[model samples]
Target chain A: MSLPNPSFAPIDWERATPATLLERIAEAKIVGMGGAGFPTAEKISLTRKHPPNIVIANGMETDPDVNADRVLLEQHLNEVLTGLRIVARILSAVHSYVVTSHKKTIQVAQGCLNDNETVRYLKPTFQNGAERELIQILTGHVVKDNRFPAFDGYLVLNVHTLFAVAEAIAGKPLTKRLVTVHDETRWIDIATPVESILESSDPIRVGCYATGHRPRVNEVLTATVNAISTDKSVHALPCIHCGWCDEACPRDVPVESLFVMAEQLKPNLDAQDALNRCNDCGACVVACPSNIHLLDHVRALRQRNDIEWERISRATQARLRVDAREQRMRSDVIRSDTKRTERMQQQHKWQ
Target chain B: MAVTDRPKFQTTGIMVHVVIALLPGLGVGAWFLGHKVFLVVLVSILAAVATEAIGTRSVQTLRDGTAVVTGMLIGLCLPPSVAIWVPFVASVSAIALGKLVFGGLGKNLFNPAMVGYALVLIAFPMQLVYLDGLTGATALDVLKHQETESLQQLINHPAFGLVGAKHFEWMNLAFLVGGLYLVLLRIVPWLLPLSVLLGIAVPALVFLPLYDATYSFGSPWFHLFAGGTMLTAFFIATDPVTSPSAKLPQIIYGFFVGSVAFFIRCFGTWADGFVFAILLANAFLPLLEPKKVALDN
Candidate 1:
């Protein structure tokens, strides 16, 4: 119920060295809690080679309908900003930003920003939280789809990661976070049994209804998970082919076609290519008038495609092995012929 | 628990609304045709529900209310003077042969209502027509038989109204109101219905000059208001399950149905062209949205 102040002391920025701060961040074992769960230490470690880098605290909270970031920013605004400053110091960031979709979070962030730091709000849309999308929105610079923003002198950290960084600087590891369980928002301990979060016979989504997956058996709460939605699952009705899912899709994926393929349980190469464009934003799930859980079908299609990928790769490898062996045998036959001709010539000379 | 983001209606909800919209049209059809219209509609609904219940043997499938809509559409498409056995046959064929045989509801290739109507229309053409039986007797039939009348004399005929067929004009207005309600709810795509109306009207206007004043094929307004033109445009042709989903595809599909219906009404043997027009359009569906392995974009 209480904010985890634990006798909080403001960081002495003048005395904090970049190497030591990075070590403290590493010691905390903090991670991006905005669904990806990427290790913060490893992420920041890569951005060191490129200077004049920008640091952004991603309070955007792209996990559809999840309130973890909003609540965290509301209660722990100082800590989140402190974590951002701590990351900024490590790389001597030229500029720092606190980006969020929540109106109140942006207002709170703006009130406490330093000279080099700025805060802005984005009109929340599906995939607005993705790295490339965020980069495109804020900087007006389109990053190549194949490349990562971190490699291009950008450091985007989830607000929860920043909060953990602040706590890490205060000599605490990331052990707990604000999680939305059903409708309740509170600090949940990492590794708590997921079943304990909500008591529903229906399948539970580990994040929000839009983007969360059904937890595996005995799955526990992790830093990446910000919500545990239960009692939301329902039987999918037949696809009326209304194209609502396609309209809702931020990536413009042909979700109805993909869903049809998924239902047939057939592997399709075209579906595989289309899946690459889909970020699994769950917009389609929200848009379906038939209450079809399109994300489930999308995931099913993904699994099918993955299996198809393995089969294709394995066949290619087998063909390559056979071709190499044939080439080696031909080369060996040529070598033996040359040796025989040399031996015959030597015998003729002796005669 | 579902985050109904944009006022989403489930399949059952959509079907319920469709049934609601059909009521006004049903009432008007019954008022114009006679008490037999009520009996025919009731028989069709009961038969369709019974067939569906027996076919699937599931109460849950019955709850979706699609059978009811199909029954209503088929009932409205038929003449009120048809024999009692006719509605039963149409309903049975609609549910069994038209819908369930193709794997039920959403998987149906053609509009179930049109399939049943077309079947009965072809099988017992005399029963469907009953031309001389009733005084009002459908405007299209009256228009077909009146070849010697001049344009001015045709307008004075009891079968001809200001713009449309005599009794059918009011019936068309009722159906239009119901359709507009559906469009307001956004259940039926507006573009599809609009395109169909334009499809029929544009050609009728173009062919207005070619009319021999002495020969009667009726005016463009008569064609628009008579028979099942509005019904097919708004309700039958716009059936989302049988129709294309995208805007462009819907436009093309609607236009094809409308133009074909116009041609058939003008030249074919049938009094109304919608039943065959819609079925022909259904056969062309795969071309509009080909089920290719890859749907680029």
Candidate 2:
């Protein structure tokens, strides 16, 4: 698949002033477009107050059937390099990395870099794709629960997200999304327009398919299309203590306890010990075959615990008021009954 | 207009919707079974409502009007020529034993109507299932007895024999229309009905091609129309508390039920497979949860 006119262009990589970088990102509204859809400009601006010494481009498409980031790395290597360089320059980071798992994609991206200074490739395993896990692989520090990589001057962005950031620096808004349509039944591979993908055919559905509204092709299919992922909000079944999800997680994280604790009352959930310990990595949610949105459940549990604590405190106050009112009513009833009996006795005596 | 914020498990609404939905079936039943079905249905509804009212008042609670609906459904499920007292006992058992003893209403584990039918089934199997010559034996009953009669011979019943089988056909239509209404109203998810319908249809269609000298597939249409399938797909099996909470799982649950009901009717212990299949699905629904994925942030 070679193009006749393949004159490649080089991207300018320089440490721009914070104001210039902010202007570039805001002009494009390129918040983190790839992963969570956070505004890229805003994230970059936040880095101005707290400078980062390292920038990592996330080219790992670890989601089982998703390949948006990997696709961009293979075909748009030069553009990706330029975007990674711009991101590094904006943050004024000394060490920059382009992380990926696909050997071909990494090789192509390396070819585009052409032995450029300050650009290196870090091969990622399944565990290394995680933001914190990648940080651990790069610099021997495993980010425990509650701690963020920004604290250690490390910021990771998906390759597509970085490309979007570069486009944002060039003043473009997000009007399109990359969708991977993998047909489980037919084995068809596609990277079609979002609308076309939505309208195409029925694929394997998961997640939100159970409880949320059924999605039509008319809707924007953001992620990959397969039985592995659903377009609807997921409904959780009551955990039957199989402990399979915990055992399956590669990170050795106990997703089942988190799910159980989220649904039922646990001693340590409310204490700082539990609340501050989440690493924000999605192993539990991924490892679960029940399609239980575990991290979402944990967040719900945290909110519920706060409400429960408040409710208990309010109930205690309410009980005291109820006791006083009941006592007053009992006394009044006794007084009235005595008067009624006396009147009845006097009337009967006369008769 | 905004969509009504109906409760997820609107047990009363479900019951009411079903009764209102059953009007066509009730009318057809009355027309074929004579005025007896009408009387039985009315009495069943009245007895059910009255019993529920008494139960509520005794407990000092406001009635939700669901018991009457259950009674009417039970009446709909029974033979028209049944004694008047039969429905009273059935309704009582449905509410008292099937429901209230289990903590009432949404707390019941089995379909209330099926529970009532089960009581009648065990206690008065003869009176409950037998109907002079007008009603004849049910299709499944014939299958269960393994009469070894040809399809042509089986269709010759005075009530159900092919030529004048209008009652059987009409009864199935009425139930189907009511079931469709429930689906259109979105009271029940489309998957359950569709899957069950397929569950019954797929095997029946296959067996129709393979139907031979020893075993008959019966009428596939008869299988869908006869017995409690319409009631089960739209009402009993759709019990939100007992059924799978999710749509995909619900569909799987429904398909398994329909398939089992068909199997039981064709090859297993009974002609009617609704109660047995539903109970079986209830036991295995926990194992069908869709696998969830963790997002790598």
lDDT of 2 at A218: 48
Q: Best by lDDT, which number?
A: 1
lDDT of 1 by residue, A1-351 (tens): 445664444446558788777776776677787777788888998887777788888877655557788889899999888888888988888998888877877776677778999888876666777777887777787878787777888888888888988887876667788998877899989999998988887877888877788889999998888899863546666677777788777787988888878877777787776898888778888777777788888888898889989999999999999999999999999999999999999999999
Can you tell me which runs of candidate 2 are displaced by over 4 Å?
A1-300, A303-351, B1-14, B50-65, B130-133, B143-148, B156-166, B209-211, B267-270, B286-297
Where does model 1 exceed 4 Å of error? A1-14, A61-65, A115-117, A231-233, B1-6, B130-135, B148-152, B292-297
Interface RMSD of each: 4.2, 15.0
| DockQ of each candidate, alpha-carbon based | 0.40, 0.01
TM-score of each: 0.91, 0.47
Cα lDDT tens digits, model 2, B18-88, are: 67888888898788778888877787777776666676565322244567667878888788768888888
* Per-residue lDDT of model 2, residues A205-283, tens digit only: 4212321224445454432332223442234333323343454455555555456566544333333345445543444
Steric overlap count per candidate: 0, 24
Worst 10 residues of 1 chain A by lDDT: A1-10
Write candidate 1's Cα lDDT for B21-77 as tens digits: 888888887776787888889999999999999999986788778899899888888
